[model samples]
Target chain A: MEALLYNLTYGFSVALTLENIFYCFSGVFLGTLIGVLPGVGSLATVAMLLPLTFALPPVSAIIMLAGIYYGSEYGGSTTSILVNLPGEGSSVVTCIEGHPMARQGRAGHALAIAAIGSFFAGCVCTLVVAIFGPLLASVALQFGAPEYFSLMVMALTCASVVGGGSVLKSLAMVTLGLLVGIVGTDVNSGIWRFAFDLWTLADGISVAVVAMGVFGLTEIIKNLGDDEIPPTLLQKKITGLMPRWKDLKQAFAPILRGTAIGACFGPLPGLGGTASSFASYMVEKKVAKDPSRFGNGAIEGVAGPESANNACSQTTFIPMLTLGIPNSGTMALMLSALTIHGIAPGPQVMTSHPDLFWGLIASMWIGNAMLLILNLPLVGVWVRLLKVPYRLLFPVIITMMGIGIYSLNSDPADVFLMAFFGFTGYVVVKCRCSLPPMILGLVLGPLMEENLRRALLISRGDPTVFFTRPISLGFMIATAVLLLMFLAPVYRRARKVAPAEEEG
Target chain B: MRLKIKSTEDFWAGLIFFGIGLYAIYLAWDYPMGSALRMGPGYFPTSLGAILSAFGLAIIALSFRLELENPAHVPWAFRPWLVLCGTLVVYGLMMRFELGFVPSLMTLIIGCSLAHRDVHLLETALLSVFLTAACVGVFIYGLGLPFRLFWWSY
Candidate 1:
C-alpha cells in the first residue's frame, strides 16, 4: 500500500507537468471532436494521429494516445444520444434509450448523464488499473518461453472464438495475418521468408500501415459506398444540462453495476467495450422494475452502458501494459506506438519505467475530468460539429491518412501498401471475416513463433514440454475450453441467431 | 443436376483462404525444415499453411449446410472503390516522382471528393485549399516534418 501510494504520488508529479497536461487535454479534445463526427472512429483517428506523436517523449506520446482512446468513448455517446447514430460500436446501446430521450427534448439530460456516468466509471477504473496492473505485471514476469507461447495461443483462440463471427473465416484471417507478419526477414535464421524480393518487404509491413488501411481508408470507402444520408442533427437549443435529483438517484445504482461489470470484462483478452456495454444493457434491463422501459427513454439504459463502456476502455490498458498483449485493434495500435518509441512492452515496462505506467493511470483520471468539462457545457459545440457533411469530411480524412502514412517513413511504398490492405480489408469484411483476430495475429505472430522455437530448443525437440509446464498446461486447457465452447452446437446456433435478434 | 452453393460469401472466402494457404505451403517448401528441437524458418509457415488449408476446406464444406434465408447480395460499389483506390495510387506516384506536396494533396482531396455522387465544385475547391493549408501548418510547420511544399521548393 505504501509503495502504491508513493508510486501514485510520483505519477502525479509526472502527469501534472504542464507539457503532459496540455497533451492530455489535446488528446481528449481531439478524441471527442472525431468521436462526435459520424462515420469516423477512434481507431482511424488514432492511426492517423500516430505520426504526429513521433516527435514527443514516449510518456507524453502514450499519454496522448490513451486519452484519444477513452476520450472517444465519451464523445461517441454524445452522437448516440442526439442523432441516434452510434459514433463507435460501444455506443450502439446508448442509441436505444438515448435517442428516444432526445426526441422528447431531453437531449441535454441524456448527454449530461452519459458524461457523468463515464466520468464516474473512468475514476473507478483508473483505480482498478493502478492496483491490478502491478500485480498482473509481477505475475507475468515469471512466465517463460513455453508459458508465453501458450498464452499467445490462448489469446488468439479467444480472439477468434469470442470475436463474434464465422470462426472458420476468422481463423483463416488470423492465418493470413500471421503470414503477413512473417514477410520481413526472420530474426533467428537471417533468411527472408516472404518478402518477394522487395526491399520494402525486408522490414515487415508496419502495423500502422495495416491499421490505417483496414480501419481508416476502408472506413472512408464504406461511408462513400453507403447510400443512406447522414442523420439530421437535433435543431432545438439544448437547455438543462444537468439531470434532476430523482433521475440521478435512479441512475446511481446502474452506474455502479456497470462499473463492476466493465472492470471484470476489460482485462480479459478478446472482450472489449462493445461486449461490456451490451452486457450492461442486458443486466440493467433484467434488473429494472419495468423491463419495457429499456428500449424506451429509460435513465438506467444510458447510465449503465455508458459507464460500462468507459470502464471497459480504461481497464483494457491493463493487459497491454502488463502482458504486452493487446486485446483489441485499438490496443494493438497503442502497443505499436510504444514499440516505435523504442519502449519494449511487457512486464518489464513497470519495473523499468514506473513513471510511464503510473503516470498514465493518473493522467487518465485527469483526462476524464477534462472530458466532463468539455462535454457538458460545450455539448452545443459538438452538436454543431455533427452538421459537417460526410462529403466534405471524408476527403479531409483520406488526405490526412495519406500524409500520416507518408510521414512515418517518407516512403511512398508504405502508402501504396496501405491502399492494398484497404482493398483487402474491404474484401475481408464483405466475406464476414472479423478483422480484430487478424490484427491480433499480425502483432503476436512473430512473438508466438519466436517463443515456440525457444521453448522447443530448450526442450530439445520434445513437444511434451508444453504440457509438462504447469503454466503452459493451464493456458493450453483454457485454449481447449474456448475452442470447445466455440464449436458447441448450442453456441453455434446462438451465434447465427444473434444478428437477427440485434436487428429486431 | 447443378450443385447449388448455399452461401456465396462463404464459398468465395473459403476459396481465397485455400488459395493463399496452398501458396504459402508451396513457397515454404523450398526452405530448410529442421528437426522439431531446432526448427528452421520454414517449419512455422509450413504448419500454418497446412492448418489454414484445412480450415479453408472446413469452411467450404460448411457452406453446403442449409441456411434458412438467401442473404441479400449488395452489389460492389465499384465507382467509389475505383476512384478512391485510384486516388491513393496517384498520390503514391506523385510522391514517388517528387510532385510537390500541395499538388499531391490537392489531387488526393479532389479525387476523393469525386467518389461521391453530389460533388459541388466550389465546396471541393475551397475544401482542398483549406485542408492543404491546414496540413502544411500541422504536419510541416507545427511538427517540423520535412516536406517540399511545391515542386520549386525542391
Candidate 2:
C-alpha cells in the first residue's frame, strides 16, 4: 500500500507538470469534441495523431492519448443523450435511456449524471490500476502460450455469447471476422495465406481503416438520407449543468453498483465497453425497485451503465499492458500503435518499461480530471452545435475526417476507402446487423490466432493442450459456462421481455 | 415506409461469405502451415478460414430461418445508395487529380448533392468552399500536417 501510494504520488508529480497537464487537457478536449461529432472516432483520431507523438517522451504522449480515450467514452454519451446519435459506437446503449431522458426534459440531469458517473468510474479504475497493475503484471509473467490460447478462447466465447442476440448470428459474425483477420501474409512461413493478391490485403486490413470506414463512414452515409427528423424537435434550454440533489441521491447507488461491477468485469478478457454496459444495465434492472422505468429515462439507468462502460474501458489496459493482449477494438488499435513504437504489450512491458506502463495508468486519473473540467463548462458550447445546419455540418465533418485519414500515411486511397466504408456501413446498419461483433472479430481474431498457434507450437501441435493446463482449463470452463449461461432458456426469456421504440 | 427486407438476401449474403471463406481455406491448404512439430504458420489461417466457412453456412441457414418467419424484417433502406456511391467516386477521382483538400472536397460534396434532384448548386458550392478553407486551416495548417498547399507540389 505504501509503495502504491508513493507510485501514485510520483505519478501525480509527473502528471502535474504544465506540459503534461496541457497535453492531458488537449487530449481530453479533443476526445470530447470527436465524441460529440459522429463519424470521427477517437481510434482514428489517435491513430492519425500518433506520428505527432513520435517526438515526445513516451509518458507525455501516452498520457495525452489515454486522456483522449477516456474523454471520448464519456463525451460520446453527451451526444447520445442530447441527440439520439452516439458519437462513438461504444455509447450505443447510452442512447437507450439517455435520449429518452432528454426527450422527457431531463437532458441536464442525464448529462450531469453521465459526467459524474464517468468521473467516479475513472477514479475507481485509477485506484484499481494503482493497486492491481503490478500484481497483475507479476502473475502475467507466468503466462505462456497455452494460457494465452485459453484466454483467447474464453474471450471468443464471451464475445459470441454476449453479442446481444442469437448465439448463431454472433458466432457467424465472429468467425467471419476471424477469417478476414487472417488475410495477411503468414509470419512463420514466407507464404501468404488469404491475401486476394492485393498489396493492401497482403498487409491485411487496418482495424482503424475498417472501423472508421464501416462505423464512422457508414454513419455519415446514413445521416445523408435521414437528415431531417421532424424539424419540430424540442430544443431544451438545459438550464444549469449541475445534477439536482435528488437526482444525485438517486445516482449514488447506481454509481457504487456500477463501480463494483465495473472493477470486477473491467479486468476480464473479452468483455468490451459494450458488454460492460449491458451487464451493468441487466444487473441494475434486477436490483432496482421499478424495472419498468428502465427504458423510460430512469436516472439510475443513466448512471450505472455509463460508469460500468468507463471502468471496462480503463481497466481493459490491465490485460493489454500486463499481457500484451488487447481485449477490445479500441485497445487493439492502441496495441497496434505501441507495436509501431517497438513495444509488444504484456508482462515484460511493465518490467522493461515501468515508466510507460505506470505513466499511462497514472495519466488516466489526470485525464479524467481533465475531462471533467473540460466537459462541464464546455457543455454549453457542444449543445450549441445542435443548431448547425446539416449541410454546413457535413462539410466540416467531412473535412476533419479527410484530413485525419489522409494524414495517416498521406495515402489518398485511405480517404476513398473511408468514404466507401461509410456507404457500406450505412447499408449494414440499415440491415440491422450489429457492427460491434464484426469489429470485435476483426480486432481480436488475429491476436487470438497468434496466441493459439504459439500455444500449439509449444505443445507440439497438440490442440488439447488448451484444456490440459490448470489455468487454461479454468478459462475454458469459464468460457463454456458463459456460453451455457447465455444460451440457457432463462437468459433468453429475460432478454425477450420488451421492445424499445425510437424517437424520430 | 421501411423497405421490406429481401426475401432471400440474408441467406445469400451468408452463403457468399461462406464460399469465400472456404475458397481461401482451400488455397491455404498448400501453404505448408506449421504443424505441432514445427509450428507451420499457415495452419491457423487454414483452420480459421475453414471454421469461418462452416459458420457462414450456419449463419445463412439461420438468416433464412429468420426471413421465413419475419418477412417484414428483410433489410430496408431510406436513402438512395447511388448518392453515397457517387460521393465516394468523386472523392477518388478528385484524389487522382491531386486536387488539394478543399477543391476535391467541394466537388465531392456538390456531386453528392447531385444525387437528389432538389440540389441548389450555388448553396452547395458555398458550403463546400467554406468547409474546405476551415479544414485546410484547422486540420492541415493548424495541426501542422505536411499537406501540399498546391495540388501539384509532388
Candidate 3:
C-alpha cells in the first residue's frame, strides 16, 4: 500500500514536468503520425530523433522515446484497419479484422475500440508495473550465464513452436539469424568472426537496417507486383463513433482478459507484441459464445488483441531494464540508447536512478492519455491518409527507410544493406517462411553466445552446470512442456482451426 | 499456378540442413567450456549443435513420412526467386565494381525490375532513378555520413 502511494506520488511529480510532458506529447504525436502511415514506422522516427535527444537529460529522453514506442503501436492500428498494410509487424494481425470492420462501415467503431482499448490497457499495465516492478526486478537479479542461456533457448523455442508455419522453416530462419548475428566482431577475443573483410561489416548489421529492410522496404518490393487497390470507405456516417452499449459489453471482457494475458506473457522473451496478440486471440476464441464470429470482424477480435499488443509493448521493457536483456527490437534500440548515455540498464538502474524509473512509469500514463486525444479526433484524418496513391506513398516509404537507416550512423552502406535484405525478405515471404523467428534469433544470438562462453568458463568444461542451476533447470522444464504442446494432436487441431477462424 | 511438392524436395532440403548441423557439431569439438564465467567457449554450442542436428534429422524423417502443405505456396516460383537472388548477386558484385551509391542502386533497381517483365522499361527506370535519388538525399546527405556523392577519388 505504501509502495503504491509512493509510486503514484513519485510518478505524478516526474511525469508532470513541463519538458517531459511536452516531449511525451510530441513523441506520441509523431509516433501516431508515422504509425498511421503504412510503411513508415515509429522506430525510424524515434531513431531519427535520437540525435536530438542527446542534448536532453537522459530521463526525459528515455521517457519520450518510450512514449513513442507505445504510441506507435496504438496508432499503427489505424493504418492496418483503414489500409491492409501494417505499420509494423505487431499490427499485422489487426489488419485482418480491422480492415474488415472498416469495410463493413464500422471504421469509426474499429478505430474507437482500438484507441480506447489501448489506452485502458496501457494505464492498467502501468499500475501493474508500479506495484509489481520491484518484486520482478528482484527476481531478475538472480540470473547468471546458464540462466540467461536457458531463457534465450526457451524464448527461441517458444517463438518457433508458436510461429504457426512450418516449424522446419522457422528453425532454419533461426539458424540463419544466428549466423548473421555472428557477422560482426566477436567481443571477448576482439577477433572479427565473419566481417567478410568489409570495414562496415566489422560492426555487423544494425537493427534499424534489418527492420527497415525486412518490414519497411521488403514490403514495398513485394507489393509492387500485387495490383490490389487500396480499400474504399464504407460509410460517411460518424454516428455510433463510440462503441454501442452491446459492443462495449462485448469488448470489456476481452480487454480485461487481454490485459491479464498480456501482463503474464509480455515479460517473456520472443512473445512481445505478436505472441501477446496471438495468445489474446486464442483465449478469446476458446471462451467465445460464438467462436464463429472470430475472423468475421468480431468486435472482440479488435479489442482483445489490440489491448494485448499495447500491454505487451510496455511489459517487454522489464527484461531490458531489470536484467539488461532486450527482448524485442525496440527494446534493443532502447538498451543501446541508454548505453550511449553511459547509463547501463540492470537491476541497479532502479536503485541507482529511482527518478528515471518513476518518471518513466508516470509518463506512460500521461502518454496514453495524450495518445487518446491524438488518435480520437484524427480518426478521419488518418482514414484520408489511406487514399494517398501507392506510387506516391511507396516513394515516401522508400525515402523514410533510407533516411531512417542513415540517421543511425550516416552510412550509405547501411542503406545498401537495407536494399539487399529487402530483396531476400521478399523471397522469404514468398517461400512462406516466417520472419519473426529471424528477428528473435538476431536479438538473442549474441547474448546466447556470450552466456554460453561464460558458462563454460565457470564450469571448467563441466556439462552439468546447465542442469544443476535451479532457474535454468526450471526454464528447461518449461521448454520441455512447450515441446509437448507442439507434439500434441490437440495443438495441431488448434493450429488448423486457428487459421481458418482467422480467414474471415 | 500453385505447384505441389511430392515430398522429394522436402527430403533433400532437410538432408542438407541435417548435414550442416552435423558439421556444426563437428566444429564444436575440443573446446572445453567450463561454466560460462570460467574457461572454454565451445561447450554449449557443441551440445546445442548436436541437438540441432538431431532435430534436423527428425524433420527429414517427418518430411519423408508425412505431408503437410499450405495453399499459398508454389512448389517453385521462378519470378520471385530470380528477382530476389538476382538482385542479391548484383548488390554483392557492385562493391567490387566500386560503383557510387547512385549508379549501384540504379543498376540494382533496373536489374531487379527487369526480372518482372510485366513492368515497362520506362516505368522501371524512372522508379529506379527515383529510388536512387531518395537514397542519396536521405541516407547519404541527410545523415551526413562522409561519403562521396560520386565514387571517384577525385
Candidate 4:
C-alpha cells in the first residue's frame, strides 16, 4: 500500500511537469475536437497525429495520445446528446436517451450528468489500472514462448469473433494482414521475403501508413460516398448546465454499476467501450423501476452508458500496457507509437520505464479532469465547430494526411502507399469485412511468429510441447472454447435456415 | 445447373483473399524451408501462406452456404476515390521532383476539393491558400521541419 502511494506520488511528480501537462492538455483538446466531428473518429485522428509525436519524449508523446483517446469518449457523447447522431460507435447508446433529453429541453442536464459520470468513472478506472496493471504485468512475466503464442492465438480468435461480421471473413482478413505484416526482410535470415525488389519494402510497411490508409483515407472516402441527408443540429439554446441534486443522486448508482461493468469488459480482447456501453445500457434498463422511462430522456440511461464507455476506453489500455497485445486498432496504433520510440512494450515496460507507465496513469486522471472542464463551460465552442461544412473540412483533413505521411520519411512514396491502402481499405469495407482483426493480425503477426519459432526450437521441433505445457495448454483450450462459442450459433442458424430454404 | 453465389460481397472478398493467399504461398515457396526446430526464413511465411489459403477457401465456401439479408448496395464513390488517390500520387511525384511544399500542398488541397460535386473554384482556391499558409506556418515555422517552402535556393 505504501509503495503504491509512493509510486503514485512519483507518477504525479512526472506528470506535473509543465511540458507533460501541456502535451496532455493538447491531446485532450485535439481528441475532443475531432471526436465531435461526425465523419472523423479517434482511431483516424491518432493515426494522423502519430508523426507529430515522433520528436517528443516517449512519455510526453504517449501521454498526449492517451489523452486523445478517452477525451474523444467525452466528446462523442456531446454530439449524441445534441445532434442525435453518434460521433463515435460507443456513444450510439447515449443517443437512445440523450437526444430525447435534448428534445425535452434538458440537453444541459443530460450533458452535465454524462460529463460527471464519465469523470467519476475515469477516476475509478484510473485506480483500477494503477492497482491491476502491475499485477497483470507480473503474471505476464511468467509466460514462456509457447504460452505467449497460445495467448496470441486466443487473442486473435477473440478479436475475429467479436469484431462483428462473418467469422470466416474476419479470419481471412486477419490472414491477409499477417501476410502484409511479413512483407519485409526476415529477421532470422538476411533474405528478403516479400520486398519485391523495392528498397522501401526492405524496411516493411509502416503501421502509420496502414492506419492512415485504412482509417483516415477510408473515412474520408466513406463520408464522401454517403449520400444521406446531414443531420440537423439542435437549434434550442442549452441552459441549466448543472444537474439538480435529485438528478445527481439518481445518476450515482448507474454510474457505479457502469464503471464496474466497463472495467470488467475493457481488459478483455475485442470487447471495448462499445460492448461495455451496450451492456451498461441493458443493465440500467433491467434495474430501472420504470423501464419505459428509458429512451425517453432518462438521466440514468445517459449517465450509465457514458460512464461505462469512458471506463471501458480507459481499461482497454491494460492489455496493451501489461501484455503488449493490442485488442483493437487504436491500441495497435498506441503500441506502434511506443515501438517507434524504441520502447518495447510488455512486462519489462514497468520495471524498465516506471515513469512512463505510472506517469501515464496519473496523466489520465488529469486528462479526464481537463476534459470535464473543456466539455462543460466550453461546450458552446464545440457546437459552433459542428457547422464547418464537410467540403471545407475534408480538404484540410486530406492536406494534413498527405503532409503527415510525407513527413514520416520525406518520401512521397509513403503517401502513395497510404493511397493504395486507402483504396484497398475501401474495397475491403465494401466486402463487409471488419478492419480491426486485420490490424490486430498485422501488429501481432511478427511477434506471434517469433514466439512460435522460439517455442518450437526450445522443444526440438516437438509440436506437442504446446499441449504439454500447462499454461500453453490452458490458452489453447481457451482459444478452442472461444472459437466454439462463436461457431456454434452460426452453425445452428445456418442449419435452421438451410432446412427452411429446402422447404421453400 | 449454374452455381450461383449466395453472397456477392462474400464471394468477391473470398476471391480477393484466396488470390492473395495463393500469391503469398507462391512467393514463399522459393525461400529455403528448414525443419521445424531450426526454422529457416521461409518456414513461418510458408506456414502462414498455407493457413491463409485455408481461411480464404473457408470463406469462399461460407459465401455459398450463408444467405445475406438485403445485400448492401454500396454505391462506389469512384470520383472521390480516384481524385483523393490521385491528389496523393501527384503530391508525391511533385515532392520527389523538388516542386516545393507550397505547390504540392496547393495541388493536394485543390485536387481533393474537386472530389465534391458542388465545388466553388474561388472558395476552393481561397481554402487552398489559407490551408497552405497554415501548414507552412505550423509544420515549418512552428515545428521547424525540414521542408522547402518554395522552389528557391535559400
> In candidate 3, what are the lDDT values of residues A185-253, reduced to their tens digit?
666655554455789988877655675677655555655655546666566554456667887888999
Better of 1 and 4 by DockQ: 4
The DockQ ranking, best first, is 4, 1, 2, 3
Candidate 1 per-residue lDDT over residues B1-154, each given as its tens digit: 6566788888888988888899999989987898899889999999999988888888887887746366666667777777888899899999998888899999999998999879999999999999999988997898777889888895
Q: How well does candidate 2 match the true structure in TM-score terms?
A: 0.86
Task: Report the lDDT tens digits of candidate 3 across residue range B22-127.
Answer: 7666654544444435534454455556655665676677666666663653344455445644554565455445565666666666665555426567876678
| Each candidate's DockQ | 0.77, 0.45, 0.19, 0.84
Of candidates 4 and 2, the better by lDDT: 4
Question: In lDDT terms, how accurate is model 2?
Answer: 0.69
- Report per-candidate TM-score of chain A alone: 0.97, 0.84, 0.86, 0.96
Question: Residue A106 lDDT in model 3?
Answer: 85
Where does model 1 sit among the CAPRI classes? medium
lDDT of 2 by residue, A346-462 (tens): 789877877777677778887887777777778878777655656555555545555556666667666666667666666555544555566657766667777876787788778
Name the DockQ score for candidate 2: 0.45
lDDT of 4 by residue, A306-362 (tens): 999889888889999999998888899899899989999888899999999999999
Name the regions of candidate 1 deviating beyond 4 angstroms: A497-504, B1-3, B66-72
Better of 3 and 4 by TM-score: 4
Instruction: Estimate the TM-score of every prediction.
Output: 0.97, 0.86, 0.79, 0.97
Worst 10 residues of 4 chain B by lDDT: B63-72
Residue-level lDDT tens digits of model 2 in B1-154? 5444333556655675587678877877777765565767666767767777886777676664354334245334344456655666667667666776666767766665554435677888887777677667776668777656568666
